[model samples]
Target: MNCPLISLKAGAVIFTVLWTAWMMWWSGAYSTANLVILAVCGAAVGYVWYRAMRWQFERMGMLPHKDDRSAQ
Candidate 1:
């Protein structure tokens, strides 16, 4: 079944957003510099994480190929 809520793209976005929000909250200080740093760092980390997860999922046949429109 193709479930949007459980897809890799959605997962990445949700993970990134939640991770960034958590880091901001955990830092306990909302300065502009801190926010910028946290956002940039969080996005980088999130991207790396997403790539890793995508690779693993593809290997395991859990995610479809980029050119596979039928999978989408």
Candidate 2:
């Protein structure tokens, strides 16, 4: 619940679907280009989600490290 990564992942999925639907509707047709854009968006979202998860884990003292072991 405290992890932002989960929320971000959900957002990515929700937005990707919405964006893809909007784009598809606007174009009035589907094509390879649209699929490529969708892929790019998904990838970008995935990257952001990964970074956010790392940051959140670090902030929450959930990241693993020898030094961290002493702190806890």
The TM-score leader among the candidates is: 1
Candidate 2 residue runs with Cα over 4 Å from true position:
1-29, 65-72
Model 2 clash tally, residue pairs:
0
How far residue 21's Cα lies from its native spot in candidate 2, in Å, is: 10
Candidate 1 per-residue lDDT, tens place, 1-72, comes to 366325766778788899999999999999999999999988988888889988787777776766674655
Per-residue lDDT, model 2, residue 12, is 64
Model 1: pairs clashing at backbone N, Cα or C within 3 Å: none
Query: Which residue pairs of candidate 2 clash?
Result: none
Using all chains and alpha carbons, the TM-scores for the candidates as numbered come to 0.75, 0.49
| Segments of candidate 1 deviating more than 4 angstroms | 1-6, 64-72
Candidate 2 residue lDDT tens string, 1-72: 334546656776776677666666777756788778866876676567667766677777676544665787
- Compared with the true structure, all predictions reach lDDT values of 0.81, 0.66
Candidate 1 CA-lDDT value: 0.81
Q: What is the lDDT of residue 32 in candidate 1?
A: 99
